[model samples]
Target: MSATAEQPPFRPRTVLLIVGVAVIAFAGFLLLIAFAPPFQGGHDARGHALSTSGNGYAGLVELTDAIGSHSLIVRDTDLLGSSALLIVTPEYDSDGAQLARLLAARAGHPTLIVLPKWLTRPMPDNREWSLKVNTIWPEGAIAALDKIAPKLAVDQTPFRKTVIPPQPAAIPRLARAAIGGQREQQRLVGMGFTPMLLDRDGRVVMGKLIGRPVYVLADPDLLNNQGLADPWTARQGWQVIDDLSTTNEIAFDLTMNGFAKQADKSPLRLIFQPPFLPVTLCIVLAALLAGLHGAVRFGAPIAAGRAIAMGKRTLVDNAAMLFRAARREHRVGAAYAALTRDLTAQATHAPARLSGEALDHYLDRAGRNAGDPPYATLAWRAEAAEDRDQLLGAARALYRWRRNRTR
Candidate 1:
């Protein structure tokens, strides 16, 4: 066997390479997600306590606890009087704010209005003196407060600011009116005191006079952890409470609890029905059958074919046959003669033998025309001779013309 015959067969490595790359890519994707950060729970700004519950009740509970513990004293009872009360109002759906306000607005105290900032409409009564507390204070209210209480320390801390805004002057008046109404009604009902329920829009929809004094705090941010630290806010809250001294002081825990019970009382349970068993079984059986069919009816593997070699002799063979046919028909003389003339002119010996004018010129040129000796002899013999003689003479003349030039 030849050395080349012993060479090894070709092997394709593309499939293996692709599978290896796919496996590596999938592994990298899984690794990327594995190290990502875990989700965060809710936190209280005031007490720095974290709770799994998402409701922002931590701040409210902290504020209520602080007040209940008597850590912060309420001041300014002289001005608010025995009937005066502190009111707390929450902004938007701030349950924390609401709970805090409720805690501060307890019985016999100046009603503190803890108004949330998200009230859609304005209160119809438009009662002034209510102090509105919210995570965000309206720009107009803030601007107005800057004039009345410039020394008031607005909680500008990021967390504090997010929960509360600058206090407005109109807040105190509105809050007081609401508390006063509630107190007046409570005294009449002998239920201790009435608390004014103000709608989202500062309007006093009900409870104008419970005969008890009232102080409205429209903003709830004042009681937040951030607000508690502020001297002005603490002082303001104290002053509202102190003004209501003389009568019993009630600390209403108005803040909503973060862990408030959910209303969904139904217990979760799974029910299994026998009716769907047939359908489920049918689907599973269909899937299994399809998988089995795919496995069993799989097509046979096909092998690739080798590249084809192009034919060369097909072109050369056709050209040779055409030239032979033309010669047998007696048309080869002119062509042969023309070719001889060119060869003779380029030849050293044939140039002299073929030289001269007219017939000599023709011979010298080495080309055979009808008048030339070789071509004329061939043509006459071709017309007179019968059968193969004419063809033989034509072939001879053609050979002689070419041979003479070569000589």
Candidate 2:
């Protein structure tokens, strides 16, 4: 009995299919890695990059959450609707009018404006920042502050202390809470605000306007990550958040943190958002499917074709086509004239001594037939022909003369 062939060992088509699947899987893995967010360390200490683990106010965010207060960082200004408090941490180059408008929008809500203090650089490992306290606010911040709250004086010197005493009336837990840090100072030397929270020396660290919902906290270190590192400061920080939780919800303003809305949406932005991602995925999948379909043959392999076995007739037809494509019809007349003359002379066995017009006359006499034009007349007509119709008539006459006279 004849053994059945083992499916030609294995189909190359199957091997190709496996390779294609592997390539597709690899591409997907690369896309996932490329678009995914970068991994971060426990503390992202970059200035104004508001992450919950950031040294900015992430600790305060956690504290608010622990105490049953609904806390959120306001990335979009539209969400800055009526709320209990809108905490703005103003940055360098902040716009004065924009700040004013935001405060005006939240007319009923209290705003706690915190001045920036640190000059910092990222760590070598890229996890956090190395900090240096800058006493002077940036020129832009100063201009914005002048416009927003002209009466407030932001102190240049940091008050160095191992411990800080807190007022319990405003922050009830502050007296027992751990409060440690060099206080960056601010006070309303002019007449718009009253002291709400004071340090052991009785200096106003936090204050509020007489009739407005506006409040000002001079020092950011009291609640930042570096400050929260100490137990006392962390407690004091919690106390501050607890005091601010007058309403159920507490909104942190990210507008000053440089998270503003763009006036226009880019096309590339649409491709990533939910509305267009599915359409983009569909297009990519269709392309991949089309590529897969074209990758492998379905049935039998096509036989190999000969590289150099073209017939003479095909070569002639191709050459004719090349002449037509080049618009070389004007050259055809001269070629035909020379060919007809040579053949006629050879067929008649005319002597070489019979030159020029004498030779032409002899061939013309020999080539003339009852229904045909003389070879001399045809040759002259062909040489003089310019247009298509004249060239066509001259060609036909020469062809007939050669056929009738040569034989």
**Cα lDDT of model 1 by residue, 18-37, tens digit:** 65588679656644443221
Q: All candidates' lDDT scores?
A: 0.38, 0.65
Model 1 lDDT, residue 7, Cα = 62
Q: What's every prediction's RMSD, in angstroms?
A: 22.0, 9.1
Candidate 2 regions exceeding 4 Å error are 1-42, 47-54, 65-70, 73-78, 90-107, 125-137, 140-155, 158-180, 183-212, 228-245, 254-278, 299-309, 314-335, 338-378, 381-407
Top candidate on TM-score is 2
TM-score of 1: 0.23
lDDT per residue, candidate 2, 1-407, as tens digits?
A: 34675446658888878877998897677655544322222255544536433347766666677778877767677777757677787765678788887887886677787666665545666545554545455343345567666766544444333333444565332342223555444333344677777655555667776777777765666777677777877777667756765687778887665565431244554575688889988997998788767875688988898774599987878877887888766567877898778877787789989877888778777745546765566777897887768888898888777777777
Query: lDDT of candidate 1 vs native?
Result: 0.38
Instruction: Give each model's clash number.
Output: 90, 3
